[model samples]
Every structure is written in structure tokens, then in C-alpha cells.
Target: MDTFHFHLHGDVQPLDRFFQNCIGSCHAYLTLREDWREHARLIQREIGFRAVRSHGIFHDLVGIYQIPWGGERVFNFQNLDKIYDFWLSIGLKPFVELSFTPRALASGDRTVFHYQANVTPPKDRGEWELLIRTFATHLIERYGLEEVQTWYFEVWNEPDLQGIFWTGSMEEYFDLYALTARTLKAVHPSLKVGGPATSRNMWVKEMLDYCAAHNVPIDFLSTHHYCADAAFEMGEFSGIHWRGQKAMLHDVQRTVQTVRQSAFPNLPVLYTEWNVSPIHEDVYGKDSEFTAAFVLQTVKDLSGLLEAYSYWAISDVFEESGPGLTPFSGKYGLVNLHGIKKPVYHAFHFLSQLYDEELVSDAPSLRVTRSPEGNVRLLTWNFVEPVNPDFHSDYPLSGGEREEEIVLEGLQGEYEITCYQVDREHGNAFRAWLAMGSPQYLTAAQVEQLKQTAEPSVCDHQRLILDGTLRIKHVLPPSGIRFYDIRRVG
Candidate 1:
């Protein structure tokens, strides 16, 4: 048994709400699918994330570029319009990732991902500039300057990955950034733009120095972090280092400290892509309930460290490497393909219900907050990292049952306590699917069953504060997450 204590009179502060700031998705082309739009609408309606980010806005499928049989290259916005219009209608702003050179404008035939996004730099600098300017001008024309100004224009995705993401030299990337930034800013100085959207938190210092010295236009700094990533330096004296469980937190902290000490202390920072592991086939996050606890742990610790951290995706309708072969194919999405909500989805749902103000508590795994109406909300979890956590190899999570006793002092009224729990037997659709023999294809009935199983098991009751102390007890299974809401009773 473990006991945690808190007093209602502790220090209070504003809850950052960084977890719901933005969510990630597959390439923008996927947004055209009915399933994808349904997922987006459901996520927005339930969790209410402010913005959505994805890759390949200029990819061929979105029809941004076309070369007629008898004419020169032309640009089209019909497909892009369908995508962004749906997002806006559903109350989501695009975080706008400017990416993957159009095949007609690419310097080479190099490509990446299952859909084969052209990774080569632009064939001609002037042509690239024309495309950028035209794109910005068209956006302003369609969405109006006021609406377009609210979106972020990130230069590219993981250009630091070199041959995989950008088949160009470091200097070439810097050149591209300068060209794109200057062109967008020229269209409208108020448009928000940023760059060096590198993986593993690379190139922050150099990017800041280069932009400052060259007088480039950059409104913010954006990068990414994954706990299982390997950190390294690019040029001379380069080396690689393996990260541990706390890697994401440490990496973002290092990036923030570096920026604060540099010339861009006041610049907003965003981890535009992040998750437990970067591997697409990793079930450590997919099928396990542990991911929910992992998300809560990291996001709570990341308060005030960054402006936004976009989870790599919203649903497993993604197909970067390729489409997921099964319902729970270890892909990085809060919801599975059948629209079944994973445990991580519940984690965000619980976090969303928390009040704006936070009350102090000494326990590392406990959060206590109160609303203006005198309702008390508490969230607590028991987390255990997977042993060795191999993305390809399935691993079992091990831990004993945890009994938690929560005692709040100086309360003297009747209150209603409602508990929502997620563990091995609660709010876990993957586990339910497995119990049904891990079917390769599910019937309509099975899908409906799984959806029902995905809901958190909820319990409620009313009680009077016993002698000015309210004591609540709960039993948490391994890697379990629980949320409690206590409100005054008439």
C-alpha cells in the first residue's frame, strides 16, 4: 500500500494545457479520406485540440504541382483546399509543415516513405522561390490574411536525417530555409514561420546563430524528441549517445536552456513531433496500457518547458512506412484504424477534464486541482517502464497491485466522488481484441464490442467529510491510470 497526502490550502498556479495544444497526423493527403476526417472530427469534439500538424503539403497527391503535356509546370490548390477546409470546419487550425519537394521541382529522383515523398532539394532556386511565394499568396487569397497568419509555416520535416529526409548538404538546407523564409515573409511580415524541425533536438544552436548572422526571418523554433532516440553531433568530432527513459524531458530541457542562453530566449519553442518511441511497429505504445501512464508522466513534467508538443498522430490511419497491417499493428496513433480509442486517448480525456488552476501535492505521481465552484479534481497513475522495450520484440509489463490512500485535510461538507479508471481490465480495447483471439479482421459486432470495452470503468458515490478529513482509497493494477472528481453535494 502507498499513501499520498495533500491539503486543500496548498500553493496554486495555472495549469499549462500543453498536452492538448496540438496533435500530429500522417501526410496532409490522408486528410481527404472520410475515415481520417471522421477521426479528426471525433478528436476535436471530444478532446478539442487547437491545431493539427502533418507532413507532405506539397506532395503530388495533394495536387499542388502539375505539368501539362504541352505546357510548363502549373500549381493547383483544389486538393489542398478540400483538406484544409475540412480541418477548419471541424475547428482545427493547420500547423502547416512545408515539405517534400514536388517531383517536377525536385533536384533528383530521391524519395522516402511508403508513398514516396520526393526528398531531393528543389531543382532550381528561382523556381522554388516562385512556388513558395505563389503558395503563400494563394493561401492569403483563399483563407484571408488574418486567418492564414494564425498558422505556422515550418520549413520541412527532419531535414537533419540527411539521405532519408533531405538528400542535400547542410549548407543546401540553410539555403532552402533562407529562400522559403524570405519569400513567405515578403508576402506578409506578420505570417508566423520557423525552422530546423530536426529530430533528436539537433541543430538548434547552429540554426539560431546562422539565422541571426544572416538576418533570416524566423518567428519561432521547432524540433522533435523521442525517448528512445540516439543523440549526436553532425560535423567534426561527431559522436552518438543512447538515451534513457527520461530522454524526452531531458532533451527538451537541454533545447530550452540552449535557446535561453542564446539570442532567442523569448522565442516560442515547439516539439512538433513526439511519442514514446519513433519506431512505427512499436507495440510498447500500441497494445499496452503503460503508454497512458507514460504520457501523463512526461506531459506533467514538461509544464512550462515548451509551448506545444504534438503527439506523432491522432489515428492509426497513417501510412508513412506503410499502412498498418492489423487493427493494432503497433503504429503511433491515439486511436486504432477501427476508430477504437487506445488507452492514451483516455489519458488525454482525463487531462482535459482537469480545472485550469492546480493545487500543490508532494507526490510525484499525483495531481490535485480545484475549480471556482469548489470541486476538487485529482489524477494519479502507477507507471512501470518496459524492460529493454524493444520495438520489434513483444515485451510483458510487470508490477504488483498498488493500493493508494488519498487524504485531504480541512474539508467539512458532503461531496460526491467519481472515479474513472484505465488499467488491464478497464478502458483497454487492445486487450479486449486480444482476448477475442486477436482476429485479423473484425466483424461489425466485434468493432462495436471493442468500442464499448474502450470506455473507462466509472464509479460514483457520495460521502460526508469525516471530522474535517476526506479519505479516498483505490487499487491500481500495473501501469494503471485513474482520475477522480469530488464535487460538493446539496
Candidate 2:
């Protein structure tokens, strides 16, 4: 192992907490479920994400648009109101994804997800426009115009996936977006709307061009990206090394450059969805401690490059293809189905505790910040990107032993030092579940055990005196994440 040194000077700058701007949920219909609400409330209370985004807002299951047998078209928002109201009650706004066409208005029976969200474009453009108007009108009527103005009405999810998420061509999506954006604006001029929510950062420039040419209103440029997308872009299925572990960061850098050079240079860029991999069964990344480092590394690297980078989801109450076969199945969520907080959950929680002022540090992996109350906080991670990425493999992501030494040469003082950490041995629920014989299903007692085991370790709590200099050394395991809270003891 080699030691890396950092001299903290207490120099600070204002920081933007962009990571918590929004969080991704499974879908709109799932919001009605009790488990989903519980997860939403927990994430809101702990991480305090500003808004929640999901697919299938207009799915038939949500019961938004309906045409009864031998009857006329009708729009109902009672159920939608419940979902939105719950989000507001918990200090969250909706990052509304106007999605999967309702069966009544869908051009075809085509659908996606196990919940079968209709993916086709509207059969009748007029009817679709009417639905969009009614949806926006009902929201404003319920939540008030002032409150609704804070929400974002994203046009659709991954329209560039074509047959999978959209049965329409690029031109057709542009038409739908134009009509929907126009309709939402007509409902209330102050309401915000934007789109081209395509995966792999596709169709952004084209969408912007189309919107500009057609005089369409687009308030922001929204898209999705994952580490796997970077890998795919590099034409590598066996592995990804675009910039070693910084592949995702490089991907965002390129996208940001593209947006900056485009006609919509000042447009708010939102990566509405992102994660280590897009695979639902990605055990190596999603289910292990690897995700904590992956998250911390990406968030640090993408500080000012993006407005919002929403992680794929907050909980494993997801059912895109169906339910997970086992308790620890590689579902893309920060918390597992039983509500056990994964390493990624604690990663966000650690970030939430950071103060607004960031202290300058020499290391790329270390972040130092000071609170108004005089407490100093440090976040550091050891990220080990996988080689020949294999999601199904049970192999651990730990690469090698790494060490760091820090010499603080600021004022001499007594301080209380506290630390929280998540690595293979700490805050990793999957490993604990595996230790319990990797049960296919969990009992209430087993669930409780896992929850307790999944908590990030709190260690190094002590009062120490710094005499002109304080030297600290750390030997971090691969994919490890740690946060330190230091408060001056007067």
C-alpha cells in the first residue's frame, strides 16, 4: 500500500448541493402503494431530495384518462392528487414524467414494464392534447398555481429507445412534445415544461433544434446516463475504462460540453436518471458496497457540471420486468425491498450532512467542508471500478488495499471527532444477507437483522487536542466510503 498526503488549509468556498435536487422512483402507479410511500418518506427525511421523478404518469393503472365502454373520453385526477399530495406532505415536489400513453389514447396496444405501461404515441393528437391540458389544470386546481410552478413537467421517458419505450419516430416524439408543451403552457403560462428525456444522452441536440425550429417551449434539457452507457459508447461489453473509474464523469463532461456549445447553452441540464449500470440485476454495483464509492465519486466529480443528477431510484419496490426473485436481487435502488438501507443510501445520507461551505483540499477523493456552527466535515471514498464488468457474478469489487495520510496544520484546538463508514464490512446489507445463508425470502426477524446489519458503522468517536498539527492516517478497503464530523470543543 502507498500513502497519499493532503494538507488542509481551512480555505473554503460555497458549494452547490446538486445531487439531492431530485431522486428517481420506479413509476407513478407504485406511488399509490404503502411500501412506496414509506420508502419515499424515509428518503425525504434522511436525504431530503427536492423532487421525485418516475415513469408511467399517464399509465392506465394510474386511471388518469379513461373511456368507459360505449362512453365518451373522461379525465380523472383523484388518484394522481393523492400521489402528488403525499409527495408534498413529505417535503418533495414532483419531477413529473409525462409518460406511457394511456390505453384509451395509445396508438397501439404496445407497452413496456411488467406493469405494462403503454409506450405508443397518441392515436389522436387532439385527444392527447386534451389529456395534457386536463392533467395540468387538475394539478393547479389541487396544488395551487404557485405550488405547481415549482414542479417540472418532463415530456416523456427515453423516447429514443424507439420500439422499447416509444413506438414513434423522432419526428413523432417532437410533435407530441410540441403539443404537450403547448398544452401545459396554455393551462398556465408559468408552469415549467421540458423534455427529450432519452437514455444515453441521446437526442438532446436534435430535440433542442426541433423545439427551436418549431417555436416549442422547452424550459430544460433532460436526459439519462449510466456508467454502462459510457461502456457501450466505447464499444466495450467486456469492460469499461474510458477514464478508468471516471467513465461516468467523462460521459457527463462530454454531454455538458455539447449542451454548452448548443443554441440552448444556458438551459438547465438534468440527468433525470443515472447509476453504475442500467441492468436491473447488477449485483456487483447495486447490491454491494461498490455503489457508495461510485456515488460519492460521481457526485464529487460532477459538482458544477449538472443541475440535477437523479439516481435511478430510492428503493427496490421496483418492478420494471417483475419482482426480484430473491431478497438481495440486484434491483437498482438505494434501499432493499425490506427497507434495509444499502451502502448507497448511507452514501447519500453522508452527503446530506455536509455543510454549504466546502474547504479546499488537494485530493480528488477527499471533500472538506465547514459548517456555520464551526464544525468541520470530511467525505472521502476509495472507488474501484470493475474490470470486465459482470453484474451476475458474486465476486467482490474490492481491488486492492489503499492508504492515505493527512496532516492538518491549522489552529490548535480540542475537537470531537466522529466518523461514519460503508464498505464490505460495514453498511453492506447484501453481504449480511449472504452470511445468513442468502435466503430466497426473509422472515420478519431476518428482515430486522438485515436492517440492523445494514447500518453504516459509526466509529472513531473521541475528543482530541491538536497542538499546531494533527496527523491522521487511514487504510481504506477497496470501494470504501467514509465521512468524518469534527466539532471544535470549546
Candidate 3:
């Protein structure tokens, strides 16, 4: 079998305390009237995010756009300084979006989705260009061009869909991008800006070709992919178990390779929006267990090619069929809005748990020893699902409850191997909730219980000593993944 080594990339989000832990924006942040600093502190505690993107910084600016659920609460320049200060305070940067026309500048009353926040682009080309320039100047003046130069400013959100989110044409999107890119660069020149922030490989070719031809000041390439029901409808895969997972990844791999060949050789691919499923139906994360397993394996596959990957939004929200809400339908959340951490969150947690040690390329199988102090990690997958009908994670998993047989070669004495796994029962936390009919809502106390159960079961698997490479037969089932800690016995 072909083997590959990977950097095991971690997804960045403000929804948790990871890395620089910068807090930023969300659809909910729009509803509050809280002091900016207070909001910033809350973000610091909750999201640990590194960047903030305003929903409508460069759109029309006249009549108000109605937010279907919250009424007319989100649009206001009064909170600009407050928002930016809190952003810098938490040490997170801005991923500014030049988007959704403000009602004031919107040429028509037609809005995408329902909120009316989906303002149409400026009817007059000059008016649209002016909006971009004004927004650009405001940023340079407030944050100072030098400091603001570091932020990533994307043009808009998913312009390719063009129904609820945008009522404009693709040609219009390109024109908007070119105008916005030029204005932002002209103001700071050093500021990083790019977009085509559409989904499922939209505009990659046109955007890349356009930038190369017009010298449109492109800096990075970004898009999204959620194997929601709609995604699979676009592409076909072979199997539903292990092969299904490989097939899922195969599609992503194909997209990346295509970009490299045609337009974006130097541009980095940033999946700004992605998750297992876009909406909730059976399980909060429908196929979350599958996504959890794919998380680890795909990182092993795409870490080198992809730069930054952020899951769609932090929490769950009302996905109604109206305006001002997420234009597309589905629950593309990393964590449920209730703040209950889901399996997807934990999968990321497990990936982050892996150490960035120099890998042994020739090592054929997964190897790892458990315990924070232990120095071994062994990783392997059954490319094919485990046929062992006896294996399952029933209740609280303990040390001995997990058992399997494997042949180890090049061994002289006994050794210890620590094991960790994400299986059908253990890794499918979201499904567990679903099977139980989605608890009348898990409380803080109840959430603690679930978090504990979701963690991996680790224990030493006998003792063995080996001098040369060894091959072993082992059993790992539950339709997911597992790891082991191997150590030389004294």
C-alpha cells in the first residue's frame, strides 16, 4: 500500500480556545447591543478565534435592510471602532469582507435570502466603485494603512450562487472584485486582498484567469466544500464505508490538482467555509462520524496543498427559507449553537492532540505509545472496514474492553502499546444524540457528561520488544479510526 506523511493541519476557529485564540464575528454578534470591549472579552473566552469579518462593510448604505428574525438591529457604523478595538485587543486579525450592498446604496429593493441585508450591487458602476473606495479609506484611516495592511480582505460571500446571496451576474462579480481589489491595494498597497469566495470550486478558473489578465492584485484563493446532500449530487463516489471516505477525499484531491494545472500554481487554497453537512436532519452532523474519520486522513492528504481551513460558522442557527439568513440551506456548524461541542469539534481536538514529530517515512504501519510522557504513536487504517462483527463501543469504554490480535515481527521481549480510537459508538457523538432523540437540550452539567464519554479510551496493549521492523495483524472496528502507543519493554 502507498503511504504518505503529513503535517496534520488544524482548523482555526474563534469558537474555541485554540492557538492564538482570537475571537471575531458571527451572525449572532450582529444582534447584540453590548459594549464592543465586553463582546471582545466574550469572544476571547468563547471563540479563541483569530479573525473577524463584518457581514456588510462595503454594501449599499441608505434605507435599512430588515433582518427577518432580529428586525433592524445589525447594520450600523456606530460600532465600527468598538468592533475593531475589541478585535485588536484579543490579538485576532480581520478577514474583512467587501460585501452585501447596504440598503442606502442598494439600487433595487430585491434582497437575497430574507434579511434584505443581501443588498443588490450599486446600480451605477460609479456608485459601486465609490462604495469600495469609501470603505477602503475608512479602514486605512481608522486602523492606519500600515497595520491594516496585514488583514485579509475578501470580496464577497459565495457570489456564484447568485440567488439569495447575490442577485447579480458573474460578470458583475468579477467587476466588483476588480474594483474592490484595486481600491484596497491603492489605499494601502501592502494590504492583502483576494476572493472569488464562492463555493464548490466556483470562479477558480475565471477568477484566476481574470486576475492574471487584468493584474487584479490577487493574493490568495478561497472557497468552500460541504459534502452536504447537494455536494454528493454533484459528484459520484464508489462505496459507503471505508471506500466511501476515500472516494470523498478523492474528489477534493481532484479539485486541488485541477487548480494547480490550470490557474493557481502559486495561490494558496483556503477553504473558508466547510463542514460534513450543511444542515441538520437525522443527526446534528448527519454523517459526522464519517467526517471525523475523514478529518484525520484528509489532513494527511491535503495539509501540504491547503493553507488555511475554517469550518463554516461556530454555532447552529435557524435555517429558515427567507432573506437575511444563510443564503444556502443546511446546518454547516462546527459546534451546535447551544455550545454543546459536537463530534466534529472533538475530531479536530484529537488531530490537535497529535504531536508534530518528525515522521519515520519507511514505517509501514501506524505506531504510537500512550500517556503524555510516552514517546510512541502508531497509526494504520483498514482501508477496508473491519469485518469483526464482535467489536463495538457499547457503554463507557475501559482499557480491556478494546481487544484485537496482531502479528509482530522483529521482537525479542515484551512491549507496551497505548491505544486511542474513534469508532462507531465513541466517535459518533452527534449520532448518539440523534439516536436518543436529541436530548431536550443538554445543559452545562449534562454537556460535561457527553464530553467525557466522547474522549478516546487509552490503555497499554501488552509488552513487546523489537529490534527490526515488525508486521502485525490487528483488529480495529466501529467504522472509524484508532491509534496506539508502542514502547520497547525492559
lDDT of 1 at 284: 56
Clashes of 3: 49
Ordering by lDDT? 1, 2, 3
RMSD of each: 2.8, 2.7, 8.5
Off by more than 4 A, model 1: 230-242, 393-399, 463-467
* lDDT of each residue in 1-490, candidate 3, tens digit only: 2333322121211221122221123442342334333434443464355665545554333222223454542433445555566567766676776677766556677664324465466666666666566666777887887788877888888787755566678888888888878877777678788888777667777888888887788887877665533433212322222123344356556656756875557776666665544443324232345445445554454444565666554444333223212111124444444434455554555444454453434332242223333344445533222221111122222222223333333333445756666665664456555565656656677566655655555533565555544444445553356665566555
lDDT of 2 by residue, 136-232 (tens): 8888888899999999999988888777788889999999899999999999888889988988788977988898788899888888877764333
| lDDT: worst 10-residue window of model 2 | 233-242
Residue-level lDDT tens digits of model 1 in 1-490 = 7887777766788888987888999999998989888888888888889899999999999978877777888999999989889999988899999998998888899888899999999989999898899999999999999999999999999888887889897778888999999999999999999988998888999899988899998888999887765433332112222255577778888999988887878989999998877767777565568788888888888887888889888999999879888889888888999889999999888888899888865677778888877778989998765665556654455566778899887665778788888987899998888899989898999999999999998855556654567888888777799899888774
Positional deviation of residue 147's Cα in model 2 after best superposition, in angstroms: 1.0
Clash list (residue pairs), candidate 1: none
Q: After superposition, how far is residue 401 of candidate 2 from its true place, in Å?
A: 1.5
Which regions of candidate 3 deviate over 4 angstroms?
A: 1-76, 81-91, 113-116, 140-147, 228-264, 280-287, 317-330, 358-419, 435-437, 442-445, 458-474, 483-490
Instruction: Evaluate all candidate structures by whole-model CA lDDT and list the values in order.
Output: 0.85, 0.82, 0.52
lDDT (Cα, 0-100) at 440 in candidate 1: 86
- Give the better candidate number (1 or 3) by lDDT: 1
TM-score of each: 0.95, 0.95, 0.68
